[model samples]
Target chain A: MCATCGCGDDAGTRVSDLDGTVHDILPAAAAPHEHPHPHPHEHPHDHGHPHDHEHDHGHPRPQSPGTADAGHSPAAEGRTLISLEENLLAKNDLLAARNRGWLEGRGIQAFNVMSSPGAGKTTLLVRTIRELAGELVIGVIEGDQETSLDADRIRSTGRPVIQINTGAGCHLDAGMLQRALGALDPVPGSTLFIENVGNLVCPALFDLGESARVVVISVTEGDDKPQKYPHMFLAADLVIINKADLLPYVEFDVERCVRQARLLNPGVDVLTLSATTGDGMDGWLEWIRKNPHPAAAAAGSAPRSGGLRV
Target chain B: MHELSITQSLVEAVLDRTGGRSVTGVNLRIGPLSGVLPDAMRFCFEVVSADTPLAGATLTIDESEGRARCRSCRDEFVLEDMFLLCPCGSADVEVVSGRELQVTSVEVA
Candidate 1:
């Protein structure tokens, strides 16, 4: 472990209500269902819930298993060389694999929604939930650095939502997604949306085991976003050009943006929509409804009540 | 941004195999597909690892470019990103390497 192995100085993420009470979404075995459950301050020191850093992170560690190949590789001078061939993101990938398997076993379709902050991701989400929540068992794992504002907005939609305050993290890694998934078990065969932290680059590199990655780029932000942040567009399965209602007022060249996105990711599909005025939302909803497993559709029919399951 | 987290892993890796010895330097092989920029890694390593045992260790990187194979013509070439065209007029290609993000070795006293 690095001497700086602690999670952080910020509070762990909390699931809160639209009002003021912060709720902890615990598993059924952890405790009986209670509404507006206050957090237990699990990591009092803000040592973030970084599952990957749980290993011997603080001290100069002893010779690890990774050093076993040291004797094979040539050592020069008096320095004792250790051969540790390990990926920098091995831990995250490992957790992501587990998440993928878990979601597959449960037949849940997870989508990673990514975009810059205020690209109308939440607004698009609210509109989607309003249209599709009645048909499918939808859940959201909202990510933000600080406030529970997004979570509150999602909660008002009457769906299971967990706000993961990343503190200082720019992107949501797989381990965090795993924890959030445990907190939000949105039934088998349901659609789980992981609204990634608002960023373009970092989130592209970290995989959260999502079935598909949808990127949102509103017209007002810039038509050159795809050219500037190519990695995000390259990693996206579907790219949405949001806030098209402001197209007349904004000087965003939609065709050029799509061309740039295509240059980065030739296989990605593009869609335009305006969440504010209910324009082009049907296509987005149809895209969400088009791909779920047939069995998940049957499972969505189960008895549903109390939008917030306490 | 995410480099801080990745740098932590690098330092953690170094300290883990250090065996309580003073680390002099580290050898890393970062592939193009690894999505890690060398500059960002160096900057973050300096900031986040200052308090760790690997504080003074020089990070030596062996950068590798991304390689891809054309799906249609089976031609091999260097890849910058997902978007590329083969000399054989084929835009269809699959990545062969450059996604590596590894710590190959650590030097300690």
Candidate 2:
């Protein structure tokens, strides 16, 4: 029988023999090019699970054109063709919404810090925390693929820090930050800084429910860094060009970097400073001071419980 | 590199939608511009689904064609590559396709 839409004479006779049910059916010419038929082949089953074993035995019959291949089924292919426009980042978006609500309720101003691997983000945080230790109570959540090294560094400065190891994940999504936030002791009048994993790509795509996003790029990494990673530049509310003290010794073009970054994000605040030497630390600290937690301040917030002073 | 994590999430999403029913297959419509690699997703699926209910579940990938529409000429055409332009030699175009990534459907038993 010709098997396009299952409307062939043979299909009709076969259906008539079974029952007098006339369901909507597609014609052979209208059928998609691919036929749905299960191909018998040996599939690997290395995991020792009973569920895996059962699935291995019963493979579903494939569907029509562009549907029945080795990987996907007919129903799935039809859904894909038909307008199943699901958001790719639905999970992240849901968590982000929840995180935003949680932060707003607490009246804490949270910001996500992003940078290249050696962009002096930790050093900047160390200096900022130390300088603002008396006025702004600060808490930090550090993200890394491996090692608690960054968290340990922040701990040495005697600040409240929580370390999240993403294992192989490239960025810190809102869900991961939510878990980390629970572990962190609440500081009523404090600013929360989430040090995202050292990646310029995926971190930009994720919203960690931060009030602002800061991107740190070192001058030594060259002026084209912003142009190369425009997504990160576009997403950042603040851009810090670190390692400014090394510009004299290294052949780095600061102007070009600033120009390109401005082209991508016209309103992005760019700050150049040397974290090691504290050359531009005051300007950085001033920016943080301007962002006051009005809701917490208005509530006559009490001092948080057991938070480290810088 | 992060494909394994994404695959694990994909498996969990399928299971969640199925309400604990056994999934026979999972279909994903990944656009060329989604920045996700099909081969990497396939490789990670096996490792991610190991010992889970979705283990051994087939993964089907569908590639979407890159298309754009010219704003100036009001002409629609397929983009030859990443350069968004109209077939009538107009660079003033807006991309309409080739940036989709979704868990289209799942076969549950």
Candidate 3:
């Protein structure tokens, strides 16, 4: 049995040398002296040493049946035994927590707005900000895969805005939103709107730590959109059927869309509105006003629900 | 398109679970209506796992059949793509399966 570490009789005990090479000591009787090789041309034994080192320490040299190098083999095996039970999305969740705290600290209610490419999310946001400009301090975070075009549109309204270009990423994760939040310079008692990238499927999977998730589905799209994309409807706290002014020209059924959405999500609030004509804007604002963030209300001991945000 | 990002997340999840251990194979279940394309996911996995422990891991995907129940006819039938109609030719149908994306298991040593 090797005396270096404790490959001897007392196997359970830990042995330490002056050189900081900690090893497990096994009882000598428990250590069997079996032949290292059961097959020909196979490496007989592998001493617990790295492969690159050449200086041979005066240890019992097992016969080299074959020349298969076992360098870095022990380290690779050691990694398998490690129990690193960590959530894969822990980092993203950490950033999301920070964002939640930041939003709560400033009494700001953040909403994640998601929709298809041609859906008028930006236009609706612009109109809402314009109408509620003096009554509410609003900030916008525009997310897109490439350009700052959405942010530019929001900037035209003279509101504080930050643009986050995801480059090739399909959705804005919590980490990206956290960075965008910092750039927006969020003030206390403000309404922050995060216009997610123009995609329906991917954005529904990611949680940006928003108080509410509003999914905008344009009436120009087929009436069966809610049924086709049920996950988006299921994740949405509110569903907005935009481009209502075009309903007369397009073959769109507003009631059918609302019914399909409700079938998927019983509690989802459905609002039909045209961003261009500002029709049905009051319903959207009323819904937001009723659902004031809990953390913000608890901080100031305000009423649980009402037109708290003006 | 979005499946590529999800594929990257799956690779990351496998790497995180196996630590630095060399994974020989990864088994995943991809349903028919999961909105994730198996070919696209395999392509993305090959690129994302290049430097990670799952670099050479073989990806095994199990495909599921889309099944739905017709609300009007009360008949169950296999769906083809986005057509949620029952075999009895009814448009009112509720999906019962074929929208799953999950990591079933992994082989490592």
Of all native A–B interface contacts, model 3 reproduces a fraction of 0.05
List per-prediction Cα lDDT, in the order shown: 0.71, 0.65, 0.66
lDDT (Cα, tens digit) per residue for candidate 3, span A1-310: 2111112233222322222232343233443222112112233334466332232334323223222222212213322221222322334445555667778787888888999998999999999998887888898988776666777788888887877656556777675676556546778888989999899887775666677789999988989998887767767789999989999999999899987887666567899999899899999988878768645474422211100100
Ranking by lDDT: 1, 3, 2
RMSD of each: 9.4, 17.8, 17.2
Worst 10 residues of 3 chain A by lDDT: A301-310
Off by over 4 Å in 2: A1-85, A291-310, B19-25, B31-35, B50-99, B107-109
Question: Candidate 2 lDDT, tens digit per residue, A53-121?
Answer: 233312232234355444344454322221223455555656666666677678888878999888988
Q: Score the docking of each candidate (DockQ).
A: 0.40, 0.14, 0.13
Instruction: Kindly report the docking quality category of candidate 3.
Output: incorrect
- Model 1, residue A221: distance off in Å is 1.9
How much is B38 displaced in model 1, in angstroms?
0.6
In the range B12-94, model 2's lDDT, one tens digit per residue, is: 56554443444667778876555457899899889877776677887888887768788889988886654454667666666
Query: Which 10 residues in a row give candidate 3 chain B its minimum summed lDDT?
Result: B12-21
Highest TM-score against the true fold, candidate: 1
Cα lDDT over the full model 3: 0.66
DockQ-based class of model 1: acceptable
Residue pairs whose backbone atoms clash in candidate 2: A34-A65, A36-A62
Q: Arrange candidates, best TM-score first.
A: 1, 3, 2
Tens digits of per-residue lDDT for model 1 on A1-310? 1112113234444443324355433244542221212222234333244222233534344343335433244444555566677777766666666677778778888888999988988998888888885698888989887787888788899888988777667878776777677667768888888898888778887777677789999999999998788668867889999999999999999999998887666777899999999899888888887866534542321110100000
